[model samples]
Target: MSIKLYDLAGIDDRRFSSNCWRTRFALLHKGLPHITVPKLFTSIHKISGDNHRTLPIITDGKTTISDSWAIVNYLEAAYPHKPSLFDKQDSLKSYSEFLQHWSLKAISFPLLQIIIKDIYDRLDPIDKPYFRATREKRFGKTLEDIVKNSEDNVEQFRSGLNPLRVSLKHRNFLSGKKPLYPDYIIAAALMWPRSMSPKQILHEDDTLNTWFKTMLSLYEGIGSKQPKEWVGI
Candidate 1:
């Protein structure tokens, strides 16, 4: 049976849906055979042809899964003979959850502020008005207003990544020398700007940048090197 991912895409296929990227990272880590079907941000509903709405939706044979963490859990359970993600699933499950939580709070929160416009500018035209208006409503401010001080905010965002930096001081990846769920959670989040914007998101001298380069090189450049139309690759 074949696998297809209703992956999120922007104006071009050089898309950066961080959550979706998490799922892709997991699948590629497990060495699964799959293909991605790009879905514009506002058009994700078409993936299910029902009330279901979200990208990075995957189907293999008769199974369908949404949410990156759940998809990874499914992949590990179903493909036990393949490479492991959590390593010892039962022992590391909660630890992975902790990493996910940390990524959401520490990385996703501030990173979203820094990259909101980059994301908006990359959205398909059909997704623009809705993306802008809905985001404005949810954020209670204009996109321009939201990102006005992003350059200043970037420093603070980098500060909050202290844990990752301190941890990386001794190891090549979050999981010692080998990349794992924790590594993917944080590294894939950085792909937000890597996919769309040319502004250097990571500080040039930060160790995080070095770690991220390694993350990009993983799985034959599948994580960072997507097909690009906006920036030079």
Candidate 2:
């Protein structure tokens, strides 16, 4: 049986959850057969009836896993015969964890100020109230207020990627020459903004922009399936 990925969705079936994207890429990377079951923000509990507050949950037979990191480990262990998401080196796994947290803090969090409103605007009507309520409580501010002057912070967001930019200066991907779980972690972070907003978060001439294009073309152009709006190349 194919794994069931209960992925988060938005208005018009947009799958914008970065955590879910990480699992999607990991599944694709391992050549695993799975199907996505889109869940609205307010309907994630319907997936497992466990009061699940988050998504990117996968059910592989009797095994149900939540959170992208745990799901990756589950996939790695359960399907050891498939392509490896990580090397045997323990340090690589630690580094992948670092990238995951870094992307969340540096990339995804900053992006919320810019794209949170867009995300709210794109939600299904049934999900809007819950989204607004939960997010307002999380940020302790109204979405409009959080997004106010968001444009002014775009440069700041871009500047925060300096460490990543320097790291990529010497390699084609974060995982040396080939894409790996670490690559998926950062790619998924960018994918969140790509799906939520119609704005280009990266500078036109940045190498990250070029690298992202390559990512869009990978795995039979999976990332390109989403409509893109970049500054320029």
Candidate 3:
């Protein structure tokens, strides 16, 4: 079945959020035919309704799934012949899947907030005001308010890193040697920091950096037709 994914494009390369990227990566990983539809964060709520959810939402021909985790679950069940995203019989896979779900949620949101603000700072003055105003109107809060909220949850965001670090250390991939749903999920969140994080942080651990580069290479392989303009890399 053909799937459609909705997301926002043309922000900074850093804002290439992991949630959206994960869904995209999963679709590609399964070798599923899919179409990408870019929408601003405001448009996502407008299209999907008051949940105020953001990109990327996936629509299979028969059903529409929001939330990256839900979409991944649906895809795995729908395409069982593909690589198993979840080893239903394995307790470790189940635990890893559970932790991966929360990790994507906890880490990506706050980190994106920080990254978005950094993007805002780099915009030209006129563009900055417009971007801030647009975000405020869409989110029902001033940009400062949003950033403040994210700052309050910084520790929760940091906690996401530990599980990922452990997962990376334990296996070549987050779940195993081959990329699974969690690998794509975590990689999507990490893509932002991987590209924009200080060289010092990215290079701190040789293993982590090597793993990150492998993920990037995988994304490029799958998203070969991804518009050059859309891909910040």
* Best candidate according to lDDT: 2
RMSD of each: 2.0, 1.4, 5.4
Give the alpha carbon lDDT tens digit for every residue of 124-153 in model 3: 444456678877787787666666755545
**Candidate with better TM-score, 1 vs 3:** 1
Q: How many clashing pairs per prediction, in order?
A: 0, 0, 3
Lowest summed lDDT across 10 adjacent residues in model 2 is found at 224-233
- On residues 63-161, what C-alpha lDDT tens digit does candidate 2 reach at each position? 888999999999989888998888655788899998888888899889998889988888899999998999999999999999898888898999999
> How does model 3 fare in lDDT?
0.63
- lDDT score, residue 2, model 1? 62
Please state the error at residue 221 of candidate 1 in Å. Answer: 1.6
Candidate 3, run of 10 with poorest lDDT: 223-232
The residue pairs that clash in candidate 2, if any, are: none
